[model samples]
Target: MKKTAYLCITALILSFTLKPSTVNAAASPVQETAKTSNHTAGIKQEQPGTLEEPAASEKPAPSEKPAASEEPAPSEEPAPSEEPAPSEEPAPSEEPAPSEEPAPSEEPAPSEEPTAEIPVQLLGANAAEKTVTLKWDNVNNAEEYVVFFLKNKTWIEISRTQETTGTFSLAGYGTKNSFKICSYNSEQRQTGESSEIKVLIPAKIKKLQTTAYSKTKVKLNWKAAKGADSYYIYGKQDGKKYKLIKTVKKTDARLNIKDKKNYRFKIVPLFKSTLGTIAGTASETSYKNTEFVSMGHQKYTYSEMCSDIQSLCKKYSEYVSYETIGYSEKGRKIYDVILGDKEADHTILVVSTLHAREYIATVVCMKQLEYYLLNYNKTVDGKKLSDIFSNCNVHYIMMANPDGVIISQTNKARWKGNANGVNLNRNFPYAFKRDGSPKDGSYSGKKAASESETQAIVSLTKKLNKTQTLAVVSYHAMGQIVFGDYGGKNQKLRSDITNMYKIARNTTGYSSAANYGGTSNGNYREYLTYKMKVPSVTIEVGSVSCPVPKYQYASAFNRNKLLILREAAWLENNF
Candidate 1:
C-alpha cells in the first residue's frame, strides 16, 4: 500500500507539470496572434513574453479598450506632421468652391454691375489765369479719374488724377469746350462716366476807346473778342466803384457817362452758351474825350480850352468862325470867336478874361456861344436866333490873356494881368493912363497898346467901329455890379449906354453904379464909350473873391444864360 501511494503521488506530480505546460502552450498562439493583429493595426505591442499570456487571455474583451486608447497615440503622432496632409487635401477641395464663388459673384459684379455716374461739378473758369477747374465726388472702387474735353467730336484726355479736384490749362483750348469725367478701377477698366459739361473759356478784349458824343453820351468802340457773343459796358465816376452801364451786341456801344464829371469805362466781352453767361477779360479802362465842357469841377486848363475851341468850330462850322488875331507875350494865340454875318450893319463885341484870375469869365463866354449856336433856329423872345443874328454880328475875345490865366491856374494865385504884367483892361489906347508896372493885379502896360494883346484889341475895335454901329461888353470878376459911364456928353450915346446897362441889370438882377458924368480911366469900357462913342458896359460877376469856387458856376451860368442873347437882340432891333 505504501508503494501504491508513492506511485500515485508521482502521477499527480506529472499531471500538474504537464497541465501547466499544456496551458502555456495553448496561450502562446493567442498572444502571437494578438501581437500580429496589433502590429497590423498599427498599435504598440511592447509587453514582455511572461505577461503576454495574461494580456492574451484578456485580449478578446480588453483588446478593444487598449485599441481605443492606442488609436489616440497614433492619431496624435501623425497630428504633428502627417495629419496636415489629409487636412490640406480637403482644404484644396473647399478652396475651389470659394474661388469659383468669387469668379461668379465678386469678379463679375465689378464688371457687370451698373456703376453710378460720376457726379461732377464745374467750378468757374479763371479768365485771367486761363484755366478751368472741375470737381467731382469720389467713386466707389475707383482707382483714378480722367478729365476729358470734346474736340472735333472726339474725346481728348486733358488730365488724370486721384484727387477730387483738378485745374486744367486752357492754353490751346478754345473759348468753349465740352468736358466729361470718367472713373477707372485698378484693373484699368472704366467704371463710371459723367454727363458732359459745357465750359466757357472767357476771351480777352484787345482794345477799347471812348468818344464823347454829347454832355451825357459817350460812344465806346473796341476790337471784337475771340469768342464773344456780346459786350457789357461798365462806367465809374470820380470816387465811385464800377457799375454795369449797358449791354450791346455790336462792338460799339453808346452809354450815358453823364455830365459834369470825368468817367472811366470798362468793356467786358461776354459769351452766352446754353449753360450760362460768362464774362471775359475786361478791356483796359478808357477815358472819354473832351466833347463836353468841364463845368467847374476843377480848373479848366488852357490846353483843354484850345481843344474845346477846335471842337466847337468843327461842330458849328456853318455859323462859327475863328481868327488868331495876335499872340500873347507867351506866344499863345488870342482867339476871336466871331458869330453872325461879318458884314452885318451892327456889331457887338464881348471880351472876357482880360484879367488872368477872371478865367471863369472865359468859361461863361464859351457857354454862351455854345448856347446861341445850339439855339440858332429856336425862337427867343419874339424872333429866332438866326433871324436876330442875321443883321447883328457878335464877336467874343475869349481867353484874351491865356498865358496869364495859365499862370493863375497852375499856381492858384490871384493874378489879374497879362503875361507881361500888364492889366489888359487898363492897357487900352482910348483913355490912356500910366499905371505902375506891377507883376499882378491892375497894372497898365509901359505904354497904351504896348502889349500885343492890347494892340490886337485896339486895332480890332477901331476897324469894327469904322464900318458898323459897335457896342462893347467887358466882363470882369469879384463883384456883381454893372458900370456904364464914360463922361459922354452926347444924348443918344448916353441914352443908349444907360439903356444897355438897364437891360443887363434887369437881366442879371445886378446893382448898377453908373458914373454917367464921371472921368475916364485906362479901362476897356471907357475906351469903347469915350473914344469909339458906342454903347459900353462893364459887368462884374461873382460875389466871392477872385478865382471863385467851382460850385459857384451854376449860379453864374443861370444868371448869364440870356444876358448876351438879349443884348444882341436889342442891338439888332435898335441899331
Candidate 2:
C-alpha cells in the first residue's frame, strides 16, 4: 500500500506542473481555461510533481474519482496568475494613452487668438487760425501716441501723449494745414498713420490810407487788424506795379506822405507770432496823383544789361581792368569792374545781391558804377571825383549770385534756392555749414565753396593778390536795416561806418535797424569779418516786400541814392 501511494503522489505532482505550462502556451484564454478545467476534473492528482496521466484503457476507482475532484484548487491558482498579467499589461500601456489625448487639446488652445491692433484717423484742420485736431481708434499694445503736422507740405512732429481716446489738438500749425498720427510701443517702432487730413487757411486783409506832403516826404497810417502783428503799406505808380512803402509795428490810424503824386495803395497784415506763417490779403484802394516820381521804363534783360556793362568797361579799358570773374550754373558770365589809374594797392570791394532777391543793391551798385564812370571829371564838395577814382581802386562785383537771381525771377513766390539749390550767400569757406533744407532761404552748399558760382567768386577774391582788400559791402532786401561785424568784441570800423550809415539813413528816410541777434551764421559778411578780419556790412534795402515795387523806385532812389553816394565818398576820404 505504501508503494502505491508513493507512485500516485508522483503522478499527481507531474500532472499539476504540466497543466500550467499547457495553459500558458494556448492561443485563446477561453479554450485554455476549458482544457484546464477538464484536465483537472479527470486527473486524480496528488501534487504537481507526483501527478501522472491515465492510460487509454485504464479506469479510475470510486475512491480515486473523489481525489480527482480536488483539481479545482490548482485551477484557482492559475486564475490568479492570469489576472495579474492582464493588470500589468494595462499599467505599461497607460503612458501612451495619456499622450494621444493631449494632442487634440493643444489644437483648440492655439485656435483661440488675442486682440488685433487698431489704426489712426485724422479729423480736421484750420490754417487761418493755426489750429489742428485729430481723432483715431485705440490700438492694441499701444502705450502712447504722436501727432505730426504738415506746413508747406512738410510733416513736422507736433506732440506726443499717452491718452487712449484719440483726440489731439494743436496750435501754431501754419499754412497748408495737414495732419497725421502714429502709435508707438515701448520700443518706439512706429505703427502706420491714419488717412491724411488737409485744410486751408483763409487770408485776412487790412486797408490803410496815406498822403505825401512834398516830392521827398510821405506820412502813412492804418487801422490794426485782429490777428495782424504788423502792417505792410504798398504804393503803386504809372509804369511800376507796386512798391512796399513802409512796415509799421504799431497801428497808426493815419500817415503823412511827403512825395506828391497819384498813388494806389494796398496793405498786407503780417502775423508776428508765426514768423513764416499767416499772410493777409492786399487791400483795395486807389488815390489820385501824388508828389512821388513815377518810374516807367523797360528794364534791361540780364543778357542785355551784362552786355551794356561790358561795353562800358571796354570803352574805358585804359583806366579799368575788366575780366570775366565767374560763370553761373547756366553759363552766364559774371564780370568784375575795377577802376583805378594805377595798380590798386589798397582795394575796397563792393558786392551786391549775393542773394537773388536783393536786386535793389545790385541796381544801386550798377548806378553808382555808371555815375563814377560818366562823371569821373566832375567835382563835388570842392574835390575832383576823377582824382579820387584814380587814387584808390574800387572793385564792384554785381550780381554775385546770378543763378539765384534767375530762380527768383522765374518763381516769384518761391524764389530762394540757386540753380543747384544752394544759398550762395551762405556758401563760404569759413564755418559754412548749418542745418537748412533747399526750401529755406539760407541753404548752404553741400561743402564749403561747393557751388561753381560761389567757388568762382572765392577764387577771384583769392587771386587778387596786389590789392589789399580793405572793406566789403553786401546787400540784401526787405527790412530797412544795416548790419555789420558782430563776430568779435573789437569794433575797429564801427564808429566811422555807423556814421556813414546814419547819413545814409537820414538821406533815405529809412530807419536804422541792426541784426542784434546772431542767428544767421555762415553769412558772407560773417566770414569776411570774423575769418578774413575784413570790415564788411550787409545793407538791407527797400521795405518788407523785397525788390521794392517799380512805382516806388523813385522814392527808394531819392531816399537811398545820396546815402550810397556818401558811402562811396566816405570810402574815398578814409581808405
Candidate 3:
C-alpha cells in the first residue's frame, strides 16, 4: 500500500510538471509571433527573455481571465512605445492647423478698423479773397494724418499731422477745389482717404484799366483780383458788345485794339466755392476807346468761307487739288487744300479755326493760301515764292471746326464747342480728360479719343511722315500770342520750334502775357510735338475779340503779314 501511494504521487508530480513545460513552450511561440507582428505594425517589442511568466500553479487560477490579462500586458508594453511616436506626429500636425487658421482670420481685421473712422469736412470758402479754410474730424487709433488740396483739377499733398483738427488756407483758390484726408498708424500703413470735400470760391473783379494806342487800336490792362480763377474781357465795338477774350489764373491783363473806331472794355471774374461747385462770376468797371475803327472786309459766315474756298480751288484747278478729309458732326465736309507742286516730297501742314469763334485766324489762313498761290513767282527777300511752293508740299486745312464757327458767329455768345458739344481745343488725344473742367469751359470730352473731330485730326496727323511733314501750325484767337512746345522729352525739336515761335511773336506782337506757361492738352500743337515729333506753334491771332470789326481786319493783316511771310520763308528754307 505504501509503494502504491508513493508511485501515484510521483506520477501526479510529473504530469503537472510536463503540462507546465508544454504550455510554456506554446506561449513562447505565440509571444514571439505577436512581437514580430507588432514590429511590422510600427509598434516596438520587448526582448524574448525580458518578460516574466507566471508559475504553472498560478496559471490555472488566471486562465478564466486570460484574454483580459493578456490584453493589459500587451497594452502596457506598447503604451510607452506609441506615446513618443504618436505624440511627435499628432502634436506637430494639430499645432500647425490651429496656427495657420488663426493667421488667416487675423488678416482682414486690420482693414476694417480705419473704415469706421476719419471724416473730411470743409469749413469756409471765399472766392473774393481767393482763399479757403478746411477742417476735419479726428480719427481713432491714428498715429498720423495727411491732407491733400486740389489745384488745377489735380490733388496735391499739402500737409501731414498727428493731431485731430487741421486748418488749411490756400491763396489763388480758384473755381474748382477738392480736399481729402488720410489716416496712418505707427507702422506706416495708410488707411485710405476720407470722403472728399468740395467747395467753390466767390468771384471778385478789381483794377480794370484801358489805354489807347492808335486811332484804330487800344490796349487794356488789369490786376488779377483775389479768388478770381479766370478773367473774361468783353468789348463794345461800334455799339455792338461781345466777349473779346479770357485769361486763366492770371493777375495782369492787356489787350490791343485794331480799327479806327470807338470801343468799350469790361472785365468779368470767375470764382469757385469748393471742390465740385459751379463757378460764380463778377463784372468790373467798363472803359471805352472812342478812336476804335472797323476793318472793311464784309462779315463772312462759315458757309461763305467754305463756298469761297471751293470757288478759289475751282479757279486754280491746275495748281490746287481739293479733297474732303472727313465730315463734321453736322455733316459739313472737312476740306483739304493741297497747294504747291503735287510732286514735292516735303509737306507743310497748316490748320486754322480749331476754336470755332477764331474767325480772324481762319481769315488769315485763307488769305495766306490766296497770297501764296497768286504770288508764288514773286520774290521777297531774294526768295522766289514759286520756288517756295515748287520745293515743298503745302496742305491748307482752312476751316477745321466749321460747325463750331457757325455757332459762334450766328448770335450765340456762349458758343465755344463743336456741333457735338465738345470743345475742339480740348478734343485732342494727348493728356485728354473728360471731367477736368470748371463746369464752364474747356471740358475735354466724354472720354479720351471720343470726339469725331479729334479722331479725324489725329488720323490726319498720323498719316503724315514725321520727316516729310516739316512742321504744323494751329491758329487760335484772342490773347495775341504765339507759343510753341518746349521743355518736353524731345529736346531738339522743342528748341527748334521754340525759336521759330519767338520769331513769330516778335514779328507779330502777339507776345506771351499770362504767367501760366504753355501746357498743351487736347490741342494739335501737343500732337505735333509729342506724337509726330514735328515742330508746331499755336498762333493766337488778334487781341481778345471775335469778328474784330470789319475795319480792323486790314490793320491786323498789316501787323501779322510780315510774321506769316517769315514763317513761310523759314519753312521753305529749313525743310
Candidate 4:
C-alpha cells in the first residue's frame, strides 16, 4: 500500500509539470488592459477634447485586437497624437492647422480677377436742362454698375443701375463734373471700375464789345469761351426777356434793327454733344447807336484819335486797319491808317502834321479817311471807291509829329517844331544841313535823321520805294497853295508832279508855287524828287493861319476828300 501511494504522487507531479500554467494566461489579459489604459491616458493628455474616441479604442484593447483597424473612421479620423486637434483646424478656429493653412486663404482669393479690366465710359452734360448722363459698354460678368461722383476728392455713391446708362441732376455740381463707375457681381461685390470722366460746362463769354455802324446796323463781338462750339446771340427790345436772335460759329454777329428802339443783348456759349446742346450763362449789356468818329467840333486829342481808330478799324475791318509805325519822343504811337488792300502794288502816302501847329491837316485827313470808308461800295467816277483803290493803297500818316501836335494844342498855339525843338521838315537826309543848336522854331537837328519823326518818315519812304510805285502828298497849313516844281530834269517826274498839282488846283482852286528848286534847305518833297525819283507835292491849306479854325474844316475837307480819290484814280489809270 505505501509503494502504490508514492507512485501516484510522482504521477501527479509529472502531470503538473507537463500542463501549461493558468496564472500566466489569466495575467496576460490584465497586463494588456493596464498597457492599453496607460496608452489611453497618454492619448487623453495629448487630445483633451477626444474622450469618446479614446474610450472606444480602450474597449477593444483587452481582446488584444489591433485598435487602428477597429476604429470607426480610420481614413477620415485624425490621430490626435500625430495630428492637430479640431480646434487647431482653420475651419473652426482663427489659428490654422499646418497642412490646412493655405487651403482657406488660397481657395477664395480670386478678388483680383475683377480688377483686371478697366472700362471706358462716356459722360455728357446738359447745362440748360441741368442734368448729366453717364453711359458705358457692358462688362463681362458684371451684374450691376454703381455710379460715384467725386466729393472733396473722395468718391461717393450716387446711383446704381443694372443697365449701362444713368442720369443725375447737375444742379449742385459745379462746372467741373468728375465721376467714375464701378461694376459689381450679384452679391454686390466690386469687380471692376472705369476711368473717371469729366463733364464740363462751357465757360461764359467775356470782353463783350458792341459797335454801331449806323442807326440801323450793329455788331457784337466777344472773346471765345472755352469748349464752345458756337455762340447764341439773344436780343431784347425795351426791357423784355432776351430771345434767341442768332446762332453763329464766329465770335462776332451783326444785327439789323429798327430806327428808334433801345435793345439789350446777351451772348451764351453753346456746347454740342451727342446727347443735346447746352447753353452757358452770360451777362447782359445794352446797345446804343453811337458814332465812333467825332464831327470835329471839339479839340481832337491823341486819345480821341486812338478811340476813333479802334472803332473805325473794327467797323470797317474789310478795308481798314492801322499799325504803329513808330513811337513819338513822348512815347505816343504814330498811327498809320491803311485804307485799301494791303497787297496792292502801288501806294499813295499822305503825311500830315509835320509841323506841330499844322493840326488842321490831321483833321482833314481823318475826314477823308472816313469819307472813303463810307463811300467804299458806292459808285463814283465810273468805279466804286473800293474798286478804285483795289490796286493802290492809301496810307495816311495821320499825325507824324504827335509830340509837336500835342505841344501846339496844349502848351503853345504856334509851336512848329517837335518836343525836341527840332524842325522835322528841315531834318531830311536829301539836303540836310545842320544849322545850329535846337531852338523854338525852324531849328534843324544836330544831324540828318536825328529825330524819331524824321527817321520814321525816311524809313517808310525807303521801304515803300523798294517794292511799290510810291507817290507822296505832304499837307502843310495856311498857304492855300501847291508846290509843283521840284527843279528836277526827269520829264516824266516833272509831268507827274504837275499832274498832281493840277488835281489839287482843280479840287481846291489853290495857287501854285516853286517851293523846291534843285538847291535848297532840307525838304521832304525835294528828297522824294531827287534821291528816290518819286513824284511828290506839298499842298498848303487854310487861308487865314496855322491851326485852321474848326469852322474852316468843312470847306477844307470838301476840297481834299475828292483829291485823294482823284489822285488814286489818276495813278491807277496812268502809273
Candidate 5:
C-alpha cells in the first residue's frame, strides 16, 4: 500500500475503490444501502403545576394529637431510695419533697407550653414579589407566630405575623435559605419553633456556552432554565460584576456579541409565578471554540442520520449541505444530503430504499456520498470528479421511508411501508389506487402522497424544479436491473429515456428494463416523470433476497458507482 494516494488514481481507472469510513457512514455498506431510518411534533412546553418542596422541608400538619406519655417516669423513683440523707438540691434529680405529705399519683403536672405546628406549605412561588409567603394551619389560642430565616447557617428571627400566612423577603439571605415558625403566648418567643420549612433556591445556571464564528462575532447560547418566561443577558468587563445587557424573550438565550475582546457574559431567567414573577438563577459563558464540529453516527437510525448529516455539513460545509426535505409517516426527518456545487447548471437527485426490506439501497447512497467527496478532486478517465461537481448538483436522499426501515431492522421482517403501514413507494399521486387496507404491506395510503415521505419527495422536486432538476434516480434492490418507466408512461417524457437507460446499463451492467418494464401503481418514478417533467429511473440493484446477503455489497457498489455521474454527465450534455 506504499504510495497509496499515487496508486489510487491508477486503481480508480482499472477498478472501483471502496473505503471503510465511506461505507460505515453512508448506510451500512451492504446491509443498509439506504437504511430504514421518531418524531413528536409539538411545541413541548413545560406544563405548569409541578412545583415541589423538599422532603426534609415538609412540615407535619397540626391536626394529629400527641401520644400518652407526658414525662419521663421520674427514673424509677431513684432506685427506691435506701435511707441516705439527701443533699441540698435534693440530689439534683429527685422531685421536690414529693409534696411533704402529698401522694405522688395524679400530681396533675401536665403544664408544659403547647408547641405550634409549623406552616404546611409556602406560597408566592408564583408571586411577582421577591418575598416568600408562608402558609400553615391556624392553631387555637395562639395570638401570633414568629418566622425565622436561616442566615449564615444560623437561625435568625425574620418576621412575626398575627395571620396564618406571612411573607419573608429572600433579600439579605444567602443563596440557600430555610425557615421555621413558633407560636407565641400573649408575649412572643414563648415556645420552641415548629418543624422548619427549608427553602431551596438555585444558585447558578447549568451550562452557559459560546460558539465563535469566523467573524469577530461570538454566538452565545445557554440551556433553557425550567419555568422561565424570559432571560436576561449580562455582560462584564475588566472582572467587574456582569451588567444587564439585554432581555431576551426565550429561555434558550442566544445572541451574537461582537467588537469585544476581553469580556464575559451571564444569563438570568424570569420564571412565571402567579404571586408575581418567580426568578431562576443566572448562567455565564465558560469558553468558546471556533473550530469544533461533532462526530457522525455509527448507525443510520432516523436520529443518527440527522445528527450525522449535520456533522458532515459542519465539517465539510464547503462541499456538502443538508436539509430536512420532508418527514416520514411517524414524523422522523427525511434528511436530504446535497453535494456538489449548488450553483451548478444541472441537478441530479438520488433516492433509495422506498422499500423497507431493501434498506441496503440506503447504504449504497451513503457510501456513494463518502466515496464521491473523497475522490471529487481525483481524476477518473481524464475527468476530475470535482470538475463534474462544478456543473452538477447531486442530491442524496438517504432512506426515503424511515418508518419502514426501522420496522424492518427491528423485527427482520418484510415491511415496505411507513409507520402507518402504507407502502410509500405506491403512495404517490400518479395512477393512484387503493392497494390494500392500512395494516397490509401493499397499502397505497388513503390518498395520493398522503405519507410524509412521499410528500417530502414531491415538495423537494417542486423546489428543485425551479433550479432545473434534470433527472432523478431512485435506488431499490433485489432485482439487478436498471430501467425507466412510470407505469410505462415513458412515451410522454420530456426527453427519450433510451439514452439514460443505456447509461445506467453501461455503468452497472444491469439489464435494461425498457422492453420488460416492471409496472407498479402510484410509484415515485412515475410522479417525478409525469408531474415534475423530469426524467426518473429506478435501479433494481440485485436479484438477491430482501436483505440481499452482506457479501453481495461489493456487487451492489460495483454496479452503481457511476450511477449519478452517468446521469449528471448526460444531463450536462443534453440539457
Candidate 6:
C-alpha cells in the first residue's frame, strides 16, 4: 500500500509539467489566491496562468482538484524581478484599533483662550501721592489682564497682569489721564477692552475769596479745584495755629468760621480712598489764603447789622423772636426783632431808625433786647419781670428802614427814605400827602404807604391790632423830645400817653413836642394813632444834627431803657 501511494504522487508531479498550457493540480489541495501588489507607476501585474483563467482578471474555474498558482519546479532560476509580487488588492493600511487607553489623546491641542469682556473700575487717583489704581472683576477662564492708556484719543496698551488690580505711577500722567482694561484667556484669546476711566488731578489754588455775612460770621468761597472731592476749611486767627474748621463736599460750599476780623482762612482740597473701614487721604496742592471784611466798627455796613442781629438773637434765643416783615425796594430785608412774652395779650411795638441818620436808635433797640433779656424773669419794682412781660409782647423793629440806615451809615447822609429815595417816615398811607413831590427831600412817595418800610410797619400795626396791642413807639434821632397823637386837645389824651411823656421827661429831661393838629401827616405815628387807634408815640433821641453817632449809644439806650418797661408794666392799669 505504501509502494502504490508513492507511485500515485510521482504521477501527479509529472502531470503538471506535461500540461503546461492546461491547469493541473498541485501536491497540496489548498486553493490558490491572487497575490496583489501595486507599483509606483500605478500598474497591476500578476504571474502566468492557464488560458481559461486570465491573470488576476477573474476568478479561476471551480474544480474539485486544488490548483498550483506557481509553475512546476524549473531547472533554472528565472530572471529576477526588480519589483516585489503585485497583490490583486492592496493590503489594508495597518491602522491601530481604537485604543481603550485613548493613546494619550494627542494632548488635545491646548484649547483656545476665552474672550475677555470684563468691565473695569477705577477706585481713585491720588495725585498728591503720585499713584493711580485700577481694578476689575475676574472673568471666567481669564488667565491674565491687559491695561491700556488712552493717548491722543487712542487706547495704547500699557501693561499686563495676572491679577485683577493694576496701578500706575502718576508722575507720567499729566493733569488728566484716561485708561482702559481688557482680559485674556488661557489660550491667549482676549475679549474686548473695557471702557475708559479718567483721572483728574486738580490744579493748584489760584484765588481764594471771602464775604462777610455779618460781624460774627464769614463765608469762604473759591473756584472749584480740578478733581477735589472736598475742601478743607482751615482758619488762622491772630496768634493762633492753623486749624481745620470744616470739610465742605461741594466746591461752592459755604460755612461760618471765626467771627473776628483778624481771622484768615486757607482752603485745601482733599480726596480719600475707602477700603472697608480703612481710608486714605491726600490733600490737593493749595497755598491760597483769604480773609473776610469787617463791617461793624470799621464800617457800619448793612451786612454787618444783619449778621450782628442774627448773632444777638441766637445769644438770647429764649427771650428774642426775629422775623423778616418785608423786603425793601433794593431787596434788603426788613427785620422785626420781637422781645418780651410772645403769648402776651398786651403788647408794644417799638420801631427805630425810620430815618437813615437816626440809625443809632437801632442800637438803642438792640441794647433794649440785651437789657430786657437780662432783666426778664428777674425782680423789677418788687414784681417778677415775667409777670410784667407774661401778657406783653414787645415788638422792637431794630431798623425800620434798613436800606436807609445803610445809606446813611456809608454815605453819611440824612437818608431818612428807603432805597427808593422816598422818606420812609412820610411814606405812610394814613394822612400821607400824595401831593408832595418825590423830588422834595422829605417827599411822601407818589402815594401813601408807597415805601416797603412803611408797608412793613403798616402790616405789623394791622397784625398787632388783632392781638390787643396797647402801644406803638417810633424812635427818631436829631431831637430829644416826646410826641404823641397830635389829634384834638392835649387834655383829651389817654392817661397812658400822659404817663409816657412824664416818664420821658423825668428820665432824660427831654421837652415834649406838643401837637395841636388832630393827626400827623404821612407818619407811622398817625397811622397807629387816629387811623388805627393804637396810641402811638414818637420819641426823638439825640440832637437835630441828623446822624447820632454810635458813641451816644450808651446815653440814648440808658435814657429809654426803662421807658418801654415802665409803659408795659402800666398797661394793665392804663389800657
The C-alpha lDDT values of all candidates are 0.72, 0.57, 0.61, 0.74, 0.63, 0.62
- Residue-level lDDT of model 4, residues 1-575, one tens digit each, is 99878765655553343222322332355445654664544332223323333343344332232342333243224354336444244344333467566543332212334463445444655666767766777877889887777767666677888888887775332355667777888886667777666665677778787655556777788888877778888899886787999889999888998666778888888776443566677757776444455645635677777878886776666678898888888888888899898888888999998998888888888888887876677786576887878899999898899898888888888889988988888888878898854556768888888888888888888888888888999998877888877577899988998898898889878887655233356778788899889988788888888777888888888778788888888888897
Query: What's the lDDT for candidate 3?
Result: 0.61
Superposition TM-score, candidate 1 onto the true structure: 0.50
Candidate 2 residue lDDT tens string, 185-224: 6876555445455443334544354433224433455566
Residue-pair clashes per candidate, as listed?
Answer: 0, 46, 35, 0, 23, 13
Residue by residue across 1-575, what tens digits does model 6's lDDT show? 99878756755664443444223322112213322222343343333222223321123232123333223324212223213343434444223355445533322211133434556666665655766777788877777777777667555667888888877864332255666677766876665456556665554454455433334444455666655666667776667787877778775444554443366567776544232111123222221122212213323456766776665554344566689999888888888877766877888888888777677777676666666665565686566666777767788877777777777777747566677778777777776775544444467788888777788888987888887756877788757888853444445345556676676677666777874333357877766666775666778888647676656666777787778887787675566
Local error of candidate 1 at residue 407 (angstroms): 1.1
Of models 1 and 2, which has the larger lDDT?
Answer: 1
Question: Which should have the higher lDDT, number 2 or number 4?
Answer: 4
Error of 2 at 470 (Å): 1.7
Best prediction by TM-score: 4
Local error of candidate 2 at residue 314 (angstroms): 4.2
Q: Which portions of model 6 show Cα errors greater than 4 Å?
A: 1-300, 381-383, 437-440, 485-493, 515-519
TM-score of model 2 relative to the true fold?
0.45
* Model 4 bad stretches (over 4 Å): 1-145, 148-186, 189-215, 218-228, 236-243, 249-253, 258-266, 280-288, 295-298, 515-519
Tens digits of lDDT, candidate 1, 1-575: 99878765655454344334435634577558866775455443433334443443343332234233333233223224323334334334445565455543322212345667877775666787777677888988999988877767666777788998987766432356777787889997778877777767557876565544556666677778878888888888868999887888898877765566766778888777554666777876545334346675647777887887776665455567788888998888888888878788987899888889888787777777877776676786666888778788788998888888988988746888877788887778766788765664667877888899888888788888898888888887757888975465899899898888988999888777653333355777777777778788888878898787777776777788788778888887786
* Model 5 per-residue lDDT tens digits across residues 19-60: 222223223333232121101222211111011111111222
- If scored against the real structure, what TM-score would every candidate get? 0.50, 0.45, 0.46, 0.64, 0.47, 0.48
Q: Per-residue lDDT of 314-407 in model 3, one digit per residue for the tens?
A: 4344456777888788888887788767777666677877767677777777776665555554685566766666667677777788787787
User: How displaced is residue 457 in candidate 5, in Å?
Assistant: 0.7
User: Which 10-residue window of candidate 5 scores lowest in summed lDDT?
Assistant: 47-56
Ranking by TM-score: 4, 1, 6, 5, 3, 2
